[model samples]
Target: MAGAGWAPPRLDEFILTEPLGSGTYATVYKAYRKRDTREVVAIKCVNKRSLNRASVENLLTEIEILKTIRHPNIVELKDFQWDSDHIYLIMEFCAGGDLSRFIRTRRMLPEKVARVFLQQLACALKFLHDRNISHLDLKPQNILLSSPENPQLKLADFGFAQYMSPWDEKHVLRGSPLYMAPEMVCRQHYDSRADLWSVGVILYEALFGKPPFASRSFAELEEKIRSDRAVETDLVVEAVRKDQEGDASAAFSLYRKALEYFVPALHYESDARRKEAIRAKVRQYISRAEELKVLVTSSNKNLLEKGNPARELLKEMAKDKPRLCAALEVASAAIAKEEEGRDDSDALELYQQSLGELLLLLAAEPAGRRRELLHAEIQTLMARAEYLKDQIKMREAQSMGKEALAESVRSGCTLQ
Candidate 1:
C-alpha cells in the first residue's frame, strides 16, 4: 500500500460494504461507519456524469421532499457525503430490500401480508393527504419492508412527491408508466384525488396477480393509460343517467360490471328494472366504498384498530411476519412501554395498524361519525410519520466490501 495512496477516494468516511442494486443512473450499496462502531447503513451512489437536467431536478426534488417530510412509509434520508467520483446519499438500510424483488417472483403477496402493507400505507397516505402531499409514483418498486415482524412499509423514492392543497391540482405527467393515473397521463389538473386513483391501481395489483393494465411494451401501456375505455362505474353512471344519451351494448356491460354496486342507479330500457337496478347497485357501491374507509371516528374513542382482510387473501403474503399473528403481543408491549413515560410515540402505532386494516376493506361505507374526521387524521399522521423517518441515522465510513459478504445470506432476516 503506497503511503500517498492516490488520496484514497474521500468517502473512505464510509467503507463500501455491499452493493444493494444497480440502475442506469444510481447504484445502491450497503455501507458502514468507519468511526462509530462500524454501524451499518445504505448508500445511494448517483453517477453525476450521466445526470442530465431532469435527473438533477429529480435529485433536488428528492432532497427537498426528504427534508420536509417523515413517516413510517416514506424512506428516511440519513446524510449526504461526496467523493472525487460521485455523490452519496446515505439512508436507513431496509434489510428486506426493494418491493420490486418481492413482487417480481411472487407476482402478489398473501392477504395477511398485503393487509399489513396496505394498512401502514393508508395511514401514511392519510398523513400526506392531510398535509396536501401527493406521492405521484406509488408502486411496489418504491415500497420497502425493513422489519419483518414490525415491518415498516417505507415509501421509497420521492422524486415525484408534490405538495397539493385540497383544492390545488398538480398538472404534471410523471411517474412509472405502469402506475400512472389516467388523469395524470391526460394532463388534467389533479389533487389528492389523484393519489386515490393511484391507490386504485395499487389495489388492483394487490387484488389481482398483475397490474390491471399490464402490457407487453412501453408504447402499448402508454396507449392504454391515454384511453383505457374500460368499464369504470363513474363513467357508466354518466352514460346511463336519465339525463344523458349514449348507447353501446359492450360498453354498458363493461360499465355494469365495473359499477356492480349501482344496479338501481344503473337502468335498462325497462323502467321497472331501472329503479330496482339503480337501488341495488347504488347500495352495493355505497357499501363497498365505505368499507374502503381507513379510519372511523366514533364518540367511544377506541384506539386499537384491526388489519385489512383483503391483504390477508394475498397468496404469497408472509406467514412468519410478526404483526400478522402477534398484534396483541405487539400492542401489549407497546402499551406497557408507552405507559413507562417515554415520548407518546405510540400515539399512531395503533392508528397505523387499524387504518391499514380499514383501507384493505375498500367497501363503500355510509358517512358517519367514524370517518367524518378521517381526512384530518390522515394529514396529522403524515406529519408524524415524516418526523420518525427523518430521525433515522446514517452510518459513518468503513471497509464494507469484505464485511458485506455475510449480508448475502438470506435467513432469519431482522433489522440490526
Candidate 2:
C-alpha cells in the first residue's frame, strides 16, 4: 500500500480509472480490461488491513452468494483476485450509476416508472429468496442501473447478505438503520422478512422522495425505529387531522403513505393478539381510504366531464358505425364509473367489454385517422383498466398483509 495517499494497488489485468464508490471496507473503481477485448467492469478493492474476523466472514459470504447466483436483475460477479494488500472483485459495469444518484437527480420518480424499477428489484429478490439468500443491506445506493436511457435495475452490494430462510432467525444486527426493520434495529432476532421491510422502504423512497425514518442523526433515526407505535400513530393522527379539516387530498395521500409502513409493522409484530388487532385497524383504515378515494374522485367528476374532448372525438368518429358508436358509449359510462370511484370491478368489466368491440372494429377498419383515433382511445381505456386492476389488487393485498402483495409482485403476476 502507498503509505499516505493510499492509491489503489496496480493490477496487470485491468486499467482502473475513476472511483465508483467507497465504503468502510472497500472501494469500487470503474475499469477496463487491458487485454484485446477491453471489456468494462467495476472492480471492488477491499484493503486486507480492513478485514476483521466478522468482515472476513461477510466477504466470504458475499463472494459465495454472488458466484452462485445468475439473474438478469442482479449484478454479475465475473471473477475475483487478491494480492498482499487488497482483494478485488470484478463485477458487471452499470453505466447508469446507482439508484441513490438516480433518485437524487430526479428528486422523485413518477409512480409508473418507479413501479417498473420495483418490479425488476422484486424479481431479483424473488430469485434470492428462492435460494434462501437474504440481501440484508438493500438500499438505493446499493442498487445499480444498467444505463441512463431505458435503464434497468440491477441489485448490487451483497456485503451483508446471508443464506437465511423465512424460518431462520439471527440476533446479530445488519443493514442500514434507515432501511432496517424494527426488529433488526432493536437488536432482536430477525428473519428474512426483514429484507421485505427494506423493500418497502425502497418503494416508499422511490414514490415519496425520501426514506420514512430519515433523520439528521443516528440517534433520531434509532428513536423513530424503536418507537414504532409512536411513528405509526403520528402519521394516522396527522391524517385524521387533515381529514377533519376537510383536506381530503392531503389526508388521502397521507393515509396511503401510512399504509406502506403499517403493512410492514403488522408483519413484524410477533404477538398473535396484537397482530390481529393491528390487522383490524389496517382494515378500517383501508375502508376509510377507499371512501376518501371515492370522495376525491367524485369531487373531480365534473372536471373530468368538462375536459373530455378526446372521448367526444371518438364518439364523433364512430357515428356511422352503430356498433362502434355503441361501444364508445359504453366506454364513456365506464369512464364516469371510474371517475365516480365506485365499483372498480364494474368499471373494469365495462372496459373489457368495450375494448373487445373496439379492437374488433379497429382491426377491420382501414389505416386512417378514424382507425388511429380509435386505437388511441383503446390505449387510454386499457391504461384506465390497468390502473383499476392495480387498485383492486392493492385493496386485496392490504387485506392479506404485505407478504401477499410482495409475493404477488415477485411471482411475476404484476410484471405481466
Q: How far is candidate 1 from the true structure (C-alpha RMSD, Å)?
A: 23.3
Model 2 lowest lDDT segment of ten: 407-416
lDDT of 2 at 5: 73
Give lDDT tens digits, candidate 2, residues 1-416. Answer: 33577666688999998788889999999999998999999999999998899999999999999999999999999999999999999999999998989988888777799999999999999999999999999999999999999999999999999999789999888888889888877778999989889998898788667787887766777787655342344467778999999987667666776676567656566655455556656766777888887876565455455547867886887778999999988898888788787799999999899999999999899998888888878887776676566567557545666563454345444422
**CA error at residue 313 for candidate 1, angstroms:** 40
Tens digits of per-residue lDDT, candidate 1, 1-416, equal 22453222337678875577667778777788899688788788888897899888888778776777778777789887776668788888898776666655676566577777788889988987887777788887778878645567888777677777888866767777678776666567767677677776775576445676777766677687655243233344543452234223223333333343233123231343334344344444334323321122221113322222322332123244334334323433433443453544563465356445434332332465333333333333343333222211101001121122123223222223
Model 1 lDDT at residue 196: 71
Best-matching candidate per TM-score: 2
- Against the reference, the lDDT scores of all candidates come to 0.56, 0.82
> Which residue ranges in model 1 land beyond 4 Å of their true spot?
1-10, 148-150, 217-219, 222-416
Q: Supply the TM-score for candidate 2.
A: 0.58
TM-score of 1: 0.51
